[model samples]
Target: MAGTIQQIAELAGVSRGTVDRALNNRGRINPEVAKKIEQIADEIGYVPKHRKKADDTVKQAGRGKRIGVVTQLSQSSFMLQVNKGIRDASKKLADQGIEVLVKENASVDEAEQMQAITELEEEGIDALAVMPVDCDNVRVKLNELTEEKNIPVVTFNSDIVGTKRYCFVGLNNWQSGQTAAGLMGLMMRGKGKVLVITGYFSNSAGSRRVDGFVEELKKNFPEMDLVGVQSSFDHTDEVEKIIVNAMSAFPDLEGIFVASGGQAGVKKAFDKLDLHKRPYVIIYDLTPKNEKALLEGTVDFLIDQEGYDQGYRALSILSDMLRRGRTPEKEYMYTEINIKTKYNLN
Candidate 1:
């Protein structure tokens, strides 16, 4: 343990010059000598110029602090926008000597989302920004990891209530739902029947959206009727079939409001049933499919929640809490409920 340079060379059976060169990067050495020096250093736990050396090694690795982003944006335009925000934020942070690493997934399920989080943990990341799959079990597991691992976790878009999280960044879901219903009532002139398509109702965001929409519709639009409600499970096939049935049952189904990125399938069902020709459709999240639907007069309006802003802000807060040790504020960020008509769609 108290080996001098001479002792190291003697024990390594190499000249002092070779050992010095290998350790200090002063001169060229053969692979065999380099391997021997490395082995002896590891065995003896040699303390080299480690402080400066470690700093320089980390510096050479990249800019400043590194944070991991785990997201589920598979194919939704909403999630894609979130990714864009992360990229722009990462680039800007790099200018300030911080690096952002992102791993984007669009799988909106608990098992897959957990796997993504697990992988990020294994990567030895300093902090995390995630849009966790909103499930009770998944949330409990994430909270456990955050507290135990000392890894800062921020939730975007949906609420992971009652946790030791850095912060929750996204809109008031109830308000967003109310806004959608208000839009639908106005577009339909507060008359005729409508069908509501919901995402996973268990997720608070999805449930709150439905509650807000229903409450507002009941409060303001007395003449408007919520004819049927369908739980789409956030799947295309189910959405399509249910919409077809609802449209047939309510031929005068003047309104259709889908609660999430379930528009792709709903749009298809409407087109197949020629429901677009009869009803006013309000879609959530403007994926390319939904954008086209808006353009083709199939989807009347798309609810725009700045998912990109949510993703970026989540990272920004997580980074600050990590690097500067700042306490995070709730500062609930609401996605702007934009109605994408033809003019705006273009």
Candidate 2:
């Protein structure tokens, strides 16, 4: 039987990536480990799998080969940055003859997303990258696009669970939320009424973040009172109204966790209340609004999910999958979860 990289790695007790590097004569590896990997390959009569260079495939697929990217442009600055990342990557790949088409929607409407995706498919894109909406209809559409049409789909930023997309490229939203909660608890000294403002309840990412925040608060800060959870739908007005109502209802609220967009609106509401002592605020994303809020003392902490990397990697991974027949080792490729504070603005 011909030996695969995995087989060689197991016999030689090394990682598949190390074995690949040793066999391919690429990357740095210890001489002894490289020799052992080579010997194992020879002992097993290993036949190297024919790998078409991704660059060659991109070149051959040639001019007019297109990748479609769909995301919400008006939702927040974060989404806008994600869009920029996609465009940046597209520019990098343009010289290689691959064109990137972007479809932007102003809101998180499932119908709008579904329509955009369907239109992209109709436009004959070779592959797709999307910031998915968590809805049954949308998931079904993605599944059909991948399973039926054989067109690869990679999701970025927000992910839709139970989809046939190749992989999810984003942060572990639950962990990010937990980190936010911990920061809030620490800032409030572990005891206070807490209110959580979530983005879209239907989306798995938002729900997971809220769930993680609530769970961590309950487990670690039992004294902290969870006032309520409000879905903002990433709308500024909605976030403002919700924050005002929650503050009015819970005057003792000492901490506010903005789990998604609308930080500007939340800041406005906080300003309106004119509390002598404002609630400790923790927001997600390091957008212009959040950055200002952090610097000006409106927001205490910010959790950023490297939006640019998410977009770039999603497109890059899908391109590699189509060009080289490579599958991501894991279903989820999580970006780094970075915590930002006023002292460390960079």
Candidate 3:
């Protein structure tokens, strides 16, 4: 039996990523650690498999291939990191003779996404990566792209149900919500009125987080009263208004959770209110604005969904499929749910 990368990593007491880098000879690692990893692999009868060298495979398979990427909520702060990942991956793929076309949408509108897809299809895209709006039409479009058009599709950041997408690369939104609920529970001492703010109700990512938070709150923090759950549509003004109105409605709101974008609006709301004390706040993303809020003690916690990895991996997965015929090991490639605070901002 051949030893797996996970086994080697476990034996070396290192991360799987480090093991992969050491074995593949891609990326930097401590020389001593790399030596130890190699020794472990040799002792365990590990054999690396590759059809061709990485560069050769990319050059051969990517020569004439094109990939299309469509992302929603383009104006949000979180998207900066995601787009950076896309741009970096695009540069790498371009060097290998592949063209990556990107379409950014400011809102989660099905019609807009459909139009973007149509345009990309007209451009003869070989594969697609999208942060799809959770709607019946978008789901149908994804299915058509994969099944009828013979174009592989990878969904990222947000996903829709009942789609023939090859895979999804992003956070497990439900678990992220549960994490928020636990954090809020701990902050409020398991009892307080809390408000929930979401980016868009139509987005499965946000909705699932809200659902998970609600279920976890009910099960564990029963005394924590949920004042309301409002959608901000990823708009700062909308988020500000929602927070202000919720605060007015629940004067004793003890905690607030923002499950998606518009975190700047949270600080704006705090400033506008100008209260002696503010509600304990939890937000998603590690954008500059959110980091500032945490540093200033406006937010209690920030949950990062690894937006960069979501963008980079989605495109990379599609490229691998088109270039090397490699299917994703998992249908849902969930990124890590990292919790950040001022104490551990790094």
Model 3 residue 341 distance off true place after TM-score fit, in angstroms: 0.3
TM-score of each: 0.74, 0.81, 0.84
Against the true structure, candidate 1 has what lDDT?
0.73
* Local distance difference test values of all predictions, in order: 0.73, 0.80, 0.87
RMSD of each: 15.2, 8.8, 6.5
Judge candidate 3 at residue 175 and give its lDDT.
97
Q: What value does the lDDT take at residue 46 in candidate 1?
A: 64
Q: What is the lDDT of candidate 2?
A: 0.80
- Candidate 1 residues lying further than 4 Å off, grouped into runs, are 1-57, 60-64, 95-101, 275-277
Which clashing pairs does model 3 show?
Answer: none
- C-alpha lDDT of residue 293 in model 3: 92
Top-scoring candidate (TM-score): 3
Better lDDT candidate (2, 3): 3
Candidate 3 weakest lDDT stretch, 10 residues:
47-56
Give the worst 10-residue stretch by lDDT in candidate 1.
23-32
